[model samples]
Target: MVIDDSSAMRLILGRIMRSLGFDVVEAPNGAEAIARLQSGAMPEIALVDWNMPVMDGLAFVNAVRREEKWRQITLMMVTTESEQSQIVRALAAGAHEYVIKPFTPDAIADKLALLGVLAY
Candidate 1:
């Protein structure tokens, strides 16, 4: 799943996910993403954006980590928040990986591979 406020970003990430042999689902914000999850959309991995309205990525990670059913979903933050402290906070909140914005598709794939969500 790709959770981002920008439709363009969603499109870009969705295309990348599809290219990597995965089905893609997208939500414009964390709240809508949660709704999709509650409605039985069980994505193996969720690429989330940090600055979205109606529930930021950190809050989404916290919410997902609190639920046993959502434990298997790998959360990756794809955002412009590049501070070392921000990355640490996201990881501490159960995000499996973090990718800053302006990243290449290869960078994303490599991170997914490192997280074991994608095969090299």
Candidate 2:
């Protein structure tokens, strides 16, 4: 799932995910993304944006980690959250991977590879 409030960002990330062989589900906010998950959307991996309306990514990460049924889903932070402290906080919140904004597909691919989520 691609969680971002910006339509352009969502479009870009959706394209990237599809290029990487994923059929993505999109949400404009963390709450909506969670709603989708509850509504039977089983995305193996979620590429989440940090800043959003309704609910932010950090809150979403904490929420996702709290759910036992969704534990199998890999959570990756894909956003402009470049601050070191913020990154640590996000990682400590159970995010599986992190990718900064303006990152190339290779960067995302590399992190996904490390997490064993990228298609072979």
Candidate 3:
């Protein structure tokens, strides 16, 4: 799943995911992502963006981590939040990986490979 407030970002991420052989789903914000989850949509991984109108990525990470049923889902922050503290906080909140914005598709692919979500 690609969760971002910007439809353009979601589209770009969706294309990247598709190139990596993933079937993508999209949510405009964390709230919608949660709603989808509640509706039984379970994607293996979610590429989440920070700084959203509804619920931010950190909150989403915390919410997902608090749920046992969603334990196996991998969360990756694909955002512009590049502060070291923000990265630590996201990781601490159960985000498996973090990628800053303005990233190349190779960077995203590398991170997914590192997380074992994609084969090299």
Candidate 4:
């Protein structure tokens, strides 16, 4: 699932996921993503933006971690926040991986590979 306030961002991420053989879902914010999940829509990997309206990515990560059933869902931070401390905070808060903005397809592929979500 791609959670971001920007429609262009969602489309970009969705296209990338599709190229990687993933079926993409979208939410404009953490609230919508949570609502979708509660409604029985589960995506294996969620690409979350750190800053957004109606709830941010950190809140979403915390919320997802609060539920036992959502433990298998890997949360990846994909945003423009390049602060080391910010990255550490997200990593500390149950984020499986982090990818900064302006990232290339290969960058995402490498991280996914490390996460065991991508083979080769």
Candidate 5:
């Protein structure tokens, strides 16, 4: 799953995910992503963005972490917000990995590999 308010970002990330053998699903905001989850879209990993309308990434992470059924989903934050404190907060909120904006596809792949989100 790729959750970002920017359609271009979503397209880029979705393409990368598909190239890496994932069936990508996208939502423009955290609320819609959560709604997708509630509707039985059990993605193994979710690439989320920080700044968005209708609910941000941190809140999404919190909401997912609160639910027992969603615990298996790996949450990765992909956003422009690059602060040490922000990273710490996302991790504390149950995000498994963090990637800043303007990243390469390789950077995303590397992080996914590091997190074991990519299946061999």
Candidate 6:
């Protein structure tokens, strides 16, 4: 799933995931993502955005990490939060990878590959 407050961001990410042969799902915020999970949507990976309304990415990461059922979902932060401390915090909060905004599709693909969510 691509979880971002901006529909445009979700669209762009979804397109990239689709091109990589993924079936994409979208949520506008962390809360909605959780709701979808509760409704039984088990996405293999989630490309989450920080600095969202309702609930942010860190909180979502923590929430997902706390749940055993969600343990298999890879969490990747695809956001503009590029500070080293922020990256550390997101990783500590259970994000498997991080990608700053203004990134090329190749950058995203590279990270997803590193995370083992994509082949090649």
Using all chains and alpha carbons, the TM-scores for the candidates as numbered come to 0.98, 0.96, 0.98, 0.98, 0.97, 0.98
- Cα RMSD to native, each candidate? 0.5, 1.0, 0.5, 0.6, 1.0, 0.6
Roughly what TM-score does model 4 have, to 2 decimal places? 0.98
Model 1 misplaced stretches (Cα beyond 4 Å): none
Q: How far does residue 73 in candidate 3 sit from its true spot (Å)?
A: 0.5
Summing lDDT over every window of 10 consecutive residues in candidate 4, give the lowest-scoring window.
104-113
Give the least accurate 10-residue stretch of model 3, judged by summed lDDT: 50-59
Please, what are the lDDT tens digits per residue for candidate 2 over residues 1-120?
A: 999999998998899889989898899999999999999888899989999999999999999999999999999999998999999999999999899999987888889889998754
Q: Candidate 3, residues 1-120: lDDT per residue as tens digits?
A: 999999999999999999999999999999999999999999999999999988999999999999999999999999999999999999999999999999999999999999998988
* Model 3 stretches astray by more than 4 angstroms: none
Clashes in each model (backbone N, CA, C under 3 Å)? 0, 0, 0, 0, 0, 0
Q: Which tens-of-lDDT digit does each residue in 3-116 have in candidate 6?
A: 999999999999999999999999999999999999999999999999999999999999999999999999999999999999999999999999999999999999989998
Q: Lowest lDDT 10-mer window, candidate 2?
A: 111-120
In model 2, the runs with Cα more than 4 Å from the true position are none
lDDT of 1 by residue, 20-66 (tens): 99999999999999999999999999999999999999999999999
Q: How many clashes (backbone atoms < 3 Å, residues ≥3 apart in a chain or on different chains) does model 2 have?
A: 0
Per-residue lDDT value at 100 in model 3: 97
Candidate 5 displacement at residue 55 in angstroms: 0.5
Off by over 4 Å in 6: none
- Candidate 5, 1-120: lDDT as tens digits: 999999999999999999999999999999999999999999999999999999999999999999999999999999999999999999999999999999999999999999998744
Better model by TM-score, 1 or 4?
1
